[model samples]
Target chain A: MRHYTAEQIAELPSKYRAHFINSCTGFKSANLLGSISEDGITNVAIFSSVTHLGSNPPLLGFILRPTTVDRNTYENLKKTGVFTVNHVNQNFIKEAHKTSAKYDGTVSEFDKTLLNEEYLDDFKAPYVQQSRIKLGCTFENEYFIKENDCHFIIGRIQHIYVDREIQAEDGWLNLERAQTVCIDGLDGYALPQILNRFTYAQPDQPVNSIKDLGS
Target chain B: MRHYTAEQIAELPSKYRAHFINSCTGFKSANLLGSISEDGITNVAIFSSVTHLGSNPPLLGFILRPTTVDRNTYENLKKTGVFTVNHVNQNFIKEAHKTSAKYDGTVSEFDKTLLNEEYLDDFKAPYVQQSRIKLGCTFENEYFIKENDCHFIIGRIQHIYVDREIQAEDGWLNLERAQTVCIDGLDGYALPQILNRFTYAQPDQPVNSIKDLGS
Candidate 1:
């Protein structure tokens, strides 16, 4: 099958068209984010454009790319408006994919990798303590795409934590019981699993499972 | 762990706060959009907010949800501006989650699902003949996300297809060898599995993989 056109994806090459348009929109959502710096130097990075934008004021968004250089989590969420996303699993996907490496703006990818920073509740951002599904966000709005200078941002969930046996008594969670992880283009990393949950779709039926419609 | 705050997730229960804020932002790309209706009828649905907004000029976006009702893929992309995005595999995740079953706008979730409707080459939207990564897109801009009346849209990436043995010689695309499927919140689904790829992270190095730096 393999086709392409759009002038052969604009004549390929540029890190192979950024790994073919970042694995052409499929499994992305590995997290990490974290942020800190108003001299508290904390950073943490890895983000696969975290999405889920609104669950009623619970918002979430991510995209960031164009700060062109020096984007310590967009300058620590513009000097501490807080941040923290976490997730990335299969036991710390290589220190959360080496927190996207580029390091140094006063160092501190949680002191170079095997990730571990906490702060929570008083959270001025910094929470990957092994991440069994975290959150804390806040910042709240940025937009700026204009066709590609990335940015997006948008946070807001103010603290969540999880891991209560991977949630689900209706508050959902259970990312395959928190083994989370899903990225694919900017360097793989998978681990999903939950193969079915259906129920709530109708038009004349034939798609059941939410445990056979026990819902 | 199970903390929650942000005033207990804005006091839960809007369908358990949309299944706990759409499975707390982790794995979501699953697709199947299709479109085509300025009288031609074709539709196809399911979308877990397809993300990836940029890859050079290739863009992609998704969010929709607030047309109040009759959203035949947002009135056929505002009347034929084009559409198609497909991926969502494991042999069509229950006919792509039963095209999010709402039906009626002259009912056409690709003629009641198990999807099939090509059109191709002359593309005026209508592709998912059982997708293995697809594209076609065009719309090109919408935004209107005033903090939650969702619309996003974007698009552009004229035609792509993919499946030549799940790509990767450097242009990535191995979404776990195309078994695709991810969306875990408004009806779960999951599948992923790669586990490692790394290799372009730098900060004094230590991540490796991309099948051991074969770049």
Candidate 2:
């Protein structure tokens, strides 16, 4: 087995960072837009650091960079305590990726990307109408990871929209079929392919008699 | 645009959950082994919920089912607070899947599956020798999703082993080259494909002008 010294591992290129690698492949992108301004929307930003925090409370979280520089999404979320997570598919990847650009606070990404926008009920935040899945979230708590200049913005999922026909027996939607993308590194996307299926069981046991881990 | 009512969305099958869909396709199988006997060896189990939490401190997390049923991994982790996150590559998926079978505490899944094992720095937990990437993690926190009854086990990565060539320029490692797999729902794995790379920028702006989000 070949071994790299600590220095070698440390000196490994930035491409070696898991985040960058994941980013290069294409990550699930979301447009975080919220309502704050009367005549204008407060902020519209995109993020890939999002993950499912919990399903019971239907919680989700994403890392937001701190407010050293003026950030529209951060400012708007702080002011309104509400945001939208709009899923990006292959068709909208270019537009979604564009949301990472730094623009003046007055510029709206939705108008630039030509992506349609929809609003739910009385919720102030607008959802991306073109997105296959969109979630309306209320801000919960933010945990800062000091080592990295990222903040975990936890949000309770208040509303969700999913395309039909992709739902499975176990209550999960098949995202790959919906052509959703996964990210690696800074500018990559990964198209997914199904391989095989096996029963769920503890990692230490035999092959037969696989039992469900969750009741 | 077709619209589904809330009742229809709720009735959407388990397969429709985006998390399960994405998870089913990308994950490969692996054995979670523990030593239950005085032999100081290993007991094996299988899991697909293992995910990289972050890299700064090199953290990883996996879901462990609760103690309602007799699970060797759940019990062993509860007893020892130590476990291994073994990657299941194309070569060892079958054997790795076998580790999920229900086995008595006394019956070692390691004895059942055809996986070889190795150790790191005298660490009590054994790593999967067949896996391209393996890591030793110490238990940090466990959050129970009361609604779903699934336990999210967060671990601090103690050791990480990866094949060198796949590492990229920006600190992203290419798992597809490493033959990594992702899980969806209960029993599926997916192979990931690279599509394209485009710079990230805020909405409505030119992609090339956008700076790295990490910056």
Candidate 3:
């Protein structure tokens, strides 16, 4: 086993520390956030921070690094008040990752990468055509983390489009069936194989697989 | 493709809606949050909302649902001001998920489930002996998400213990190698097989795997 105290971690090289700390947390959800400038220049960038916030209002949130430099996705989404969250799948991990490369403000990543853009349901933002699961979200709210100059941006799910094959009868979407990729650190992508789905847990009984119930 | 507008989603049954919305956000990092009450009782619960907040200070955050009910993990961490985050793995998915079973406040999930607890380096909280990657963290700050009655709790990484086998030369931990499982929804666990690790992206160059560089 390897051990690192706080002091030791702080003394590590910056890049090495970034990779170490990032991957140490565990697997992160991978998605491409698609937004468009007021001029209609579309921007798509890969984000690992998209997290499910709640289910009642169908809200989701992602951490936006401080806008110290030009953050086109933040700027565009704030300006347009809408953006799309597209799941990065196994087939397009390469193209999806390329979206993270720093491109000029006016130059759209859609044009530079192989990822094609499609506007769904007259939504102002563009969606990655290859993503099997997509969500059209409206900007909700953001809270600034005082410990770090990061914005926790929240969005409301206004619309959803999913491949029919991946959804189970109980409404759970089979991510492995959808081939949605998860990110490790900043660059490693992985495909998950569903091992088991348990039924609603109870204190007195042993865990039972949902498959055991013939679902 | 199945399309659902905001109204349609809001109209679905609560359980069905939760399953739909939770799985739609892509795979989530799964871990067990271990905390100890002042009276010395330990609590460990499965958390899928754990997300990387930053790397420089080595910070992580997770969403805590409203404490309208008995949330021993929340109360213990708040009182003790420390907790441990242990990654869920392939071998213990059943035992890990069982942590979510609502046991009485006096009952420790660690004792109820097969997970054994080991205290490390005089840390107030207990670490899961079965986990390959473990983090001892101090509560830093929390932001109240007014949109949903939830709290985004932040923690500073003070200690890290990892199995040596999963680390890469450049400091990234190979989560797949570690056999860490990702969460599909509330109850579904999946193990990820790493597909590729890419080098830092540049706008002008095509994506290249780190393996290509012979690292």
Alpha carbon lDDT of each predicted model: 0.81, 0.56, 0.90
Query: Which prediction has the highest DockQ against the true structure?
Result: 3
- Candidate 1 has which clashing residue pairs, if any? B197-B210
Looking at model 1, give its docking quality level. Answer: acceptable
Residue A120 displacement (Å), model 2: 3.4
Please tell me which model should have the higher lDDT, number 1 or number 3.
3
Q: Which of candidates 2 and 3 reaches a greater TM-score?
A: 3
> lDDT per residue, candidate 1, B99-191, as tens digits?
787887787887786688888789888888778889888898887778887877788888898878788788888887788989888898988
- Angstrom error of the Cα, residue A150, model 3: value is 0.4
Query: Candidate 3, TM-score vs. the true structure?
Result: 0.97
> DockQ, in order, for the candidates?
0.33, 0.29, 0.88
CAPRI-style grade of the A/B interface in model 3: high
Candidate 1 chain B — worst ten consecutive residues by lDDT sum? Answer: B206-215
Q: Which ten residues in a row have the lowest lDDT in candidate 3 chain B?
A: B206-215
Q: Please, what are the lDDT tens digits per residue for candidate 1 over residues A84-104?
A: 888888987888887787776
Candidate 1 chain A lDDT trough over 10 residues, lowest sum: A206-215
Clashes of each: 1, 79, 0
What is the two-chain DockQ of model 1?
A: 0.33
Candidate 1 vs candidate 2, DockQ winner: 1
